[model samples]
Target: MQNSYPNRQWIYVKRPEGRVGPEHYELREEVLVGNLAANEVIVRASIISVDPYIRIQQHERNTYDVPHPLGIVQRAGVVGQVVASASPLFAEGDWVSTYSGWQLYARCHHSELTKLDPSVAPVSTALGVLGMPGRTAWFGLMDAGRPRPGDTLVVSGAAGAVGSLVAQFGKRAGCRVVGIAGGPDKCKFLTDTLKLDEAVDYRAYSTLESLSDAIQAATGGVDVYFDNVGGRVTDAVIPLIKRRARIVICGAISQYDGGLDKPDLGPRFLQHMLFQRATIQGILARDFINRMDEMVATVAPWVRSGELHFHETYVDGFDELPAALNSLFDGRNLGKLLVRV
Candidate 1:
């Protein structure tokens, strides 16, 4: 082993007014001197996640939480191997997951690391299916969506990570699933691979009225709406809820750029909720962090057995982190988007 390791990091330098891009970040390289305190471990990042929430946090205004403090490493989920450790629980060459952000290497405390067993599933899954995205989809759907047999479940952003899992979970719950995504290829993925009962391509319709009609045509009425994308897509789904419908707001990717700061309050559809006695609730992954085992126990088996489909789009190289995050708004990724370190 070398006495020092080369480390590179993407620092979040500026907040974006509209779309996020490379301009918002600064990449710096340094040599990490091998000096570890007791119970400390140094892990070399192999995979890094670029998610929508990172964009949301960039906004000066608070959404789910306060804005991410600038001039620091872009915070994210990373899967890596321990290169050096003074901790008794971890050793050299052990795979682990940590919230160590967009850095080639991280020095973390023993408790900050989650030891991963690669034999159970691919270590990469710790950032995808069996990780935060999986947890978000599981609890967000089952708890907040409260799907039942024979119910009609409509999922927006259905081709993406959390949305895709919610769609499948709805299917497993015996609900007829209708997925809404942009583009034809993602729509086909929703129907052919995810086996959703119907897949509506929002991009096919230029107007909200047309999109609403398409959604209504596919689903007579929505008993449960698992919404991941807000803006026009959400506007279409809101008015289609059935009696006693449950709406789970997992995300609003369309608004993450600038809409969050100055939201466009579109046409009013709360009357639909009033007529149907529908309930709308917002959920976050952190809310269910305590019950992570419950989510893993149920979802991990299906993942390991190949019963559940977890698609991931990987961008090669650490330099692509900012670009990968920016690409999320363009709807370029079919599922969880990650950067290979």
Candidate 2:
């Protein structure tokens, strides 16, 4: 029965020069041409996650994952329902999550998918809080930042998917959390909704001196810095780092769009790191996949009990994936961004 429906997919067409647009992708509709193999199951997408990392994946060559090939579906994490199955592992109507990309239906072996239970939380969360973003926050904080009680923890891109959770984790660990976000509204959401100790609007300050002053006013100095959006915000925060500070480089969204060839040259801050005895480390979620169960055990309760609040910006339709992705670089998304198909 599922074979009767046309499959629509967004295929990568060209390498994005700077910011990716709809022109970089080609949406093609093709009829399902064959039956599922014995080990395969077919999934109908319900929600597709549009992330900043996808922009990096658009390059013809990348170190993070295999570079997407031309005319192939754009890769992304998706939450969907099984509609047809030759695999005994997944029956029709079961919810699953996979790296199936921007497509209406995906047929893959059962090993490629993770089963999700909607009864525990919204299945969409499999692509958000209870999924990679949440795990990124948990492991990156615990492993890289290593917050101590009463320590001043600061996070850039604080209103974002990973950054918001990192702020909450700091609060839970008895640290004073300060968030740096784009605008006044996002800054408000960080303080009022996410309950960070302080929030700084990076957009409000034009110079590094003024930004540093705001950080100094907030928590005196930062002991741990969870950096999601690097560049100017990082430059400002470096001057205010306390002794023996730990800086976790998670995602540099500020540089992901266009600065690959000619990188932003900023003031040399290695001296500050040397004098402060601060340590900086770059982290990838894939490195800590084994600890995902530990993260879920810790964060799932907070989510279920309403202690940890998560926000999501939903854009309807698969065609909006490019626009939804572009929103991340534009600071248009409040939290985890998703496209409901």
Candidate 3:
């Protein structure tokens, strides 16, 4: 047993069944026995992020999985408190952000956990609104989606973690944002709460014709489509784009379960891209490395001013990880999902 501390962690156990299951992950408790090297910090996790994209990385994976050898705790960025430090930048009680995965304790090099500005935003926001997801929203819209003022922006996964913030940012930039979500509650939250120009329930309109009609009625033509869950939804949106439209391919959570044999789109879709002079891109948020400090500076004020709003779904127990992760992919989470460690 650890003399003064208990060490515990969750590791990816087996290739998931279809998507993921409790059996896919195994949490083991052990004694804390480690020494921090110079310029390292020991972080006792405060909140753990449970994101939908985590579903895709169980085995040999392309795209987001990125060859992270299996058996490590699933990769997730976390916010935590410094329990011990070996560098001048951090001391006890400091809060920081790092890709610490789903574990109770994380030992990180000093630079791994970026010191959070206490006056700017909540520490939890570092994992959501003021963090990667937020920057994902900010850059994806401006860089790939390219929502010009008065242009119509369509966002899928439109009420979940990244989508909600994207919608708000689109509105602030003077674009009319239309949202497409999986169900009625999400639709309501997006349209009624976030005040999107229109919100379509993907469940209500099963056919492409009806879904297109809903989009057509919303803003006449889509100037930008921010895709989160791919497959049919994207196939449907491809035909409805206006000239010079931009499609931001962020994540395809829908296809993670369906595997690599995802549905192929019509040949005419590629022809449309050429004919309309459109653009499509896959964004990894880390690519905007040069602008992170500036991005945080810009968004932090909005968060502090309450111009930006964030909702987090909290699961109270560390052992409830599987269920919490289930809530993420199933659209049970309204905004960000965090396991309170």
Give all TM-scores, in the order shown: 0.98, 0.97, 0.94
lDDT of each: 0.93, 0.89, 0.81
Winner by TM-score:
1
Please, what are the lDDT tens digits per residue for candidate 1 over residues 278-325? 999999999999998898889889988999999988899999999999
Q: Give the TM-score of candidate 2.
A: 0.97
- Which 10 residues in a row give candidate 1 its minimum summed lDDT? 1-10
Maximum-lDDT candidate: 1
Candidate number with the higher lDDT (1 or 2): 1
* Candidate 3 Cα RMSD after full superposition onto the native fold (Å): 2.1
- Give per-model CA RMSD: 1.1, 1.3, 2.1
Clashing pairs in 1: none
Task: Give the per-residue lDDT of model 2 (tens digit) for 1-341.
Answer: 33655899999898887889898889899876438778798889999998888887776667487776778898999999998988888999999999999999888899999999888888988888899999999999989999999999999999999998899989999999999999999999998898898999999999999998998899798899999988999999988898999999999899888775457898899998999999999998888899888888888888888889889889999899977887789986888999999
Clashing pairs in 3: none
- lDDT of candidate 3 over 1-341, digit per residue (tens): 12235767888877664667687778888755547778877888888888766776654556554745667877788888888777788988988889988888877898787888777788999889888888898999887787889999999888888989999999998999999898889888887889898898887887877877877787688899999888777777877888999999888877776454354453347887888889899996777766888778888889999878788878898888877887666766788888888
State how far residue 195 of model 1 sits from its true place (Å): 0.8
lDDT of 3: 0.81
